[model samples]
Target: MLCATFSQIEIRGKKGRTVPVLLTSEIESNIDLLLQHREMAGIHPENLYLLPRSNFNSKEPIRSTDVLRKYGKEANLCKAENITSTKLRKHIATISQVLNLSRHDLETMAEFMGHDIDIHRSIYRLPQETIQVVKMGRLLSAFDNGTIVQYRGLDEITNYLRFKGGLLTLVL
Candidate 1:
């Protein structure tokens, strides 16, 4: 999109839900530069669509297929695989698993992702293999350090360590 403002965005998400999104500082700067260039190029501000149709009289948005071809060729990615917006979505989801966000942060992310908390937990959470490997490594480290506690269910540990308001105070 050529002229999208990056401060904040309100998008119609999956199932027509209105989702609010805020941009990072880097993205905001980039969008500001792009908008300034567009103004210098004499592109009229009356057109509201970020990716406007080429025809002056047309109000429709630019076709996605046209954008795909241009983007692929410019990035030299057309030969590797079919690159689409869907790939970008999955890429973000995959990398997000590594972030150590609180429960409230996870819920906010789920809303931005256009899904309920349950769907986010079941689908976007780290893969079982990754989780097991990381946890196993931590357990081994604790054992080696002689700090390992007796094996008990996660519920018992969480209940014992959780703050009075049910917030998890343990990190790791």
Candidate 2:
């Protein structure tokens, strides 16, 4: 388990899954500077976890307040002088933008920053129309392959198809 102020990260096997993280107010204080800058770019702190690199230096481990303070100075944010967690969040937010972190990267950052999984998904994982198409394609493929063993009901099938944006017509 890799522990940071924002979150506790546990990396599993090659095809492993990430565990849920609990974000506390204490971790929020550490990234205050970054959050401030993110808000300026129309990105909310609640959505900060969506970015790949929320912190100024993604390569370094920001597990301590002293490290945060030192980084702030190097970034010319003077975080220690400011003393507001909000300020620190904003500063980090600004750096994140400068670094051009991607959405996938943001998810990793969210994990690193100790944001809850739900919060991370809500902000970054917007629903898309294409998802339906993909599902429909898979269903059709399964049908062709004779892999669809037992479908529950018309409504259940339709609902499943609807995910792929498909409309069902009961021929029976």
Candidate with maximal TM-score: 1
Off by over 4 Å in 2: 1-114, 150-158, 161-172
Encode model 1's per-residue lDDT on 1-172: one tens digit a residue.
5335445688666688987767877877776786667555445567666655546555566766678768888888747346665566566665665454567987787778776888777766677678556566655665578665553344323333435484434434
Put down candidate 2 lDDT per residue, 15-36, tens digits, no spaces.
Answer: 3545454566676665576655
Each model's total of backbone clashes? 0, 28
lDDT of each: 0.63, 0.50
Clashing pairs in 1: none
User: What are the candidates' C-alpha RMSDs?
Assistant: 8.5, 18.0
* Model 1 error, position 120 (Å): 2.2
Model 1 misplacement above 4 A: 1-6, 24-47, 63-69, 78-82, 133-172
Model 1 residue 77 CA deviation in Å: 2.2
